[model samples]
Target chain A: MSGVTGQGPRTDLLAAVEQVRALAAKHAEETDEAARFPVAVLDELRTTGLLGLLVPAEYGGLGGGLDELLDITMELGRADMSVAMIFSMHCQQVAGVVHHAGPRLAGELLPLVAAGRMYLASVTTEAGKGGHLLTATAGLTAEDDGLDIDRFAPIVTGGEYADGFLITMRSPEARSAGDVSLVYAHRDQLTITPSGDWNPLGMRASHSTALRLTGRIPEHQVVGEHGQFRTVVLNTFGPLAHLGWAASWLGTASGALSRVLRLLRSPDGRKGANLDSELLMTRLSRSRQRLETVHALMRHTAEVVTRVRAEGDDLSRPRYQMLINSLKITASEECHRAVEDLIDAVGLRHGYLKGSPTGLERALRDLRSAALNYSNDRLHLADGKLALLDAEVRFA
Target chain B: MDARFTELLTPYLPYLGDRELTADTPLREYGLDSMQAIELMLSVEDTYGVELPDEQLTEETFSTAGKLWDALSGQLGGQGSDTAPAADAV
Candidate 1:
């Protein structure tokens, strides 16, 4: 698909992203300090027509794909990780609707997104299920003409600001937790009450707070077939989420590295003993290598996803599952490690100070959340089980 | 009904200890999760030398021992044989 105005999608999207980046960069410090959402950045995204990024061109969107998603997210991550994460998550839900929504629902929602009038939020996390996206403790109740949903999400990132939500819940006739469905509801269709405050060590601008949601949705609003949300999770949501987050973390690490490089090239750095120390140079080099490794792996996984989608192949295959899960695990860990290495290379004053000109302090705190975002330990456990069945590792 | 099938599946279903592995037993009740189901599918394929097609990969197919056995039998029978290869022979 071409750009919104017939220009190249990549170029047009990146140009708009550059504008958002400047705004996010400008407000990132205050956003983090105040523990608030970056309203200005989001406004820029809407005005630039980037909110409709993943919707198809026929629906008045740019019709961009996974590759474009990675580029936009990486750029945003460089400016502010919270902005990057919010945008990435929005795209994840858009992809879900675009790929799995029934024709009528698609026709209804995609144009609003394409017109940059909507921002979608994810509602997968339940109170007790920590990072488990495939199952739900809340079950939909059958009503006269639709299903009644009363779910308490433990953490809904950007929930208050979202124009709509894609929620996961047990089907009305579900016999087990795995019998799940993905449902969509506009903000006006539901009563969303904030239940708790969100004050975190990092990524504070995301406003991931507990929320109580009550609503009624028609059966037609279900994204896929009843009790078949597993297919949607494994196919679209899983891969795109992992890739988008990995790219965001990669951009965060690279942003810190850029700060470090700037310091090294300054006249004061040249006059001081810092530039001459091989140890410092070596540490920076190691960080660079790690970041580069993450970038390469993330790009490769995105390409694989694009290829699989293009070929009409199933992405839930064990090999692809392993690949996607492994990317999240590796990128989260490596990006954090790269940031830590840079912190040590730059020394205590610049790296440890809260308001240091280097800005590594904020980057460090933001990148720290990467490992705990979805919890790498949980993913490793899942991958460990999958590794037993998928013994052969084929690389093409 | 096959001893090899029982042997291959038993390890993953420790929750089903000492119970007779019947055709109608609900696999999920015996702690068969999505990942475990996939692992079980792979083992069945490796042991029986038959690939379960993508169309057959569904929650219903792995909902019970009977359904899973039927899927495996279908694949094995499609290879022009009613009898599975001997457990001890392979």
Candidate 2:
């Protein structure tokens, strides 16, 4: 198939990331301190062509895959976790649009994303689902103009700033919550009632707030085929989001550690004649090893998901999903440990304040969101359930 | 139905229950959703080692066992001349 409307996968990823780092560094402090949207960072991302990095080149994008996205997100995460997260959410939405939607729909939306004129965000959470993403408490009704969707999403990441939002709802002909449908709507088509604030412990710049949305959008905005929401979510959106989340964690932790490494190499740290340079170096090396492991796992999982898409049915298996979920848990925990060790290498006494030499406090706070984003406790339960299934255990 | 087609498709049609599928039986009536349809199609392609053209993947191809058989046979160059448009569709 022809790639989306752009040049082939971007060859200048390094150059683009260098520009993004500058923007991220400029906005990281105030954006996090005020819990504001990283508008400047996003604008720079769009201007630098990094916004369409994951979009197919045929659609005027870079045509890069998960690996390229990971590289960009990790660099962004190193600079600013919030900006990395917002970009990841945008990419996940783009994947749903290009991969699952029919050709005509893809033609309409992908170009806009590819051109950096649009950003997609998903609204899948509901008030009564109790953290279950697969189920929806809302319903869609067929109207004369199109479909009328009125639902309350307790939390929509990037909702306020999104150009388009993909929604999950029970199908119009459904008898139960299991029959779900997904649709995309231009932000102007919906009335989004802000239900809550977004101030949080970490990743404060993501703009994840609760919203009540009521809208009527044209039929063409519906994503995938009707009644295929479960399959599409499992096949496309779920995998992208999971991998993107892991990459974000890896990136942010690495960025914070880089600061600590700088501190270790400074005159203050090395000037002490009796300082245990060997021990500090070893600690930093071990932390780097942990980040490397996280990177490898994320890379391997993305490759597996890509292969499954081409080969079919592999990603849908319960065992494969279990393994992917474990990667999220492992990456989150390992990333936290890496940041902590880097902080120790920087020494706790000097500049131990919030905005310290290494900014370890902020990194730790941001890393905390990884585990709580989907909750490791819930993921472990899912793995336990899969343990009893009769299935082939395979890997890439 | 071709014997190979029957053998490959039967394993995926547990939803058809006790009703034996003939070449005339519409596959969709047995509650085979898109995913299952794709699964059966892929299984046929894998078994016969013939890649079905993307344009041939539609509600029409798998509407009935006969149509699917025709599509597969045509691609495989088997020349099975039972080409009645099986119309109890998906």
Candidate 3:
């Protein structure tokens, strides 16, 4: 069930990512204002060959691994977080398919991804489930040609616009919520209902609306072995999503600091009567330092994930889980602080604006999602268990 | 360890490739690092329904396929014989 990776070279893959980032930057403001999904950015990603970043090359993809995907994701995050996040969700879904799904399922979906025709969204997280990702409130029943999927996934990140979903649901034969399966459901096969409006303070363009879905999942589309979604989530989707979100926050920090850097270099900043150039420079350096820390954490975690995939090793280990959780907590908090420092350096006139000509206010709001999206509280509790049990765990 | 258990684990060691994986082959030769070693350990627990003690997670227990099999055999209350040949190993 294991396969090789890195069929594409890094430089070529990053070139495609840079193009997507340009498009994302162009549409970022409007996407945030309208709180709408970035349709144009998605189209640009597909055209640039970045949408297939995680699919293996044999299936017509770039054949890039998790490390390669992280490079693209972080760069995208730096340009437009909404686009990065939307793409991150797609990447997580791709990770699930590539690493865990049966060959027939991968054969069916990887081609569409390679051709830039489809995006896979993770349809997990129910209303009452809270942060319990493994438990499924909805259930799947076996039908004639496939299984009937009936569930109301409350927060599907790219659900409104995604072509398909990597959905979590309980099997008909399962005894409890612990016995769950992840199934693939195309948008055409599902009746989707928009249950909630997306109007978040930050990452407003993610279009993470609540969705009610009814569909049929064919036998081949049932990703991973039965009751193995926990393994899939712990080893594949969890790390990708956490690191991707960290990259987005780091990008937000980078974008905010870039604006401040521009301000520092302008005539008003350099030779103006009321400016303290040295103090501003100090703050700028501090902000950059924090961003660098976040980047280092993201890079190290990405390398481990890529190595595990390359070796075809099991991902569900106590140590790996500890790393993913800690990355999310530290990166989120540090990014928020970095963006705040940038705002302080820029001051009121430039910092208070919602959109560009210096977008500190918007950056702060967008970066705020890092701590709230997965709630560092939950991650801390998870890490607490590892801290007690594992005395000599290393981050790298 | 049950010979069937060693057969189940052989595939997890990516370096085996098309080569025959015998119990005597050193686990380290198959590129099993500490992380992969832990991964194999967890899978063994899951597959065989036996919880390996923390003390048994050392490099000595995982030096070779035969050593791992012997550890699991002890943990499983002697389900598998340790002194069998390659053919009888399974």
Return the top candidate by lDDT. 1
lDDT of 2 by residue, A35-141 (tens): 88888777777777777877788889888887777777877888878888889879988888878887888888888887878878888888877777766778999
Number of the candidate with higher TM-score, 1 or 2: 1
Q: Per-model i-RMS in Å?
A: 5.1, 10.2, 12.9
Candidate 2 residue-wise lDDT at A216: 98
Best by TM-score: 1
- Regions of candidate 3 where Cα sits further than 4 Å from its true position: A1-9, A271-278, A393-396, B1-90
| Fraction of true interface contacts that also occur in model 3 | 0.00
TM-score of each: 0.88, 0.78, 0.80
Candidate 2 chain A, run of 10 with poorest lDDT = A1-10
> Model 2, residue A320: what's the lDDT?
65
Ranking by lDDT: 1, 3, 2
DockQ of each: 0.19, 0.05, 0.04
Cα lDDT tens digits for candidate 1, A1-396: 332221223765667888899999899999999999887788888889898888999999988888788878888898899999999999999999999999999999999998878989999999787678777899999899999989999888899899999999998887668778999999988999998778899998998898889999888999998877878978899998999899889888888889778877889766643677899989999999999888888878987888888897777666788899989999998998998898899888778888766688888889888888889898888777756545454442
Give the CAPRI rating of model 1: incorrect
Model 1 reaches what TM-score against the true structure?
0.88
Number of clashes recorded per candidate = 0, 11, 1
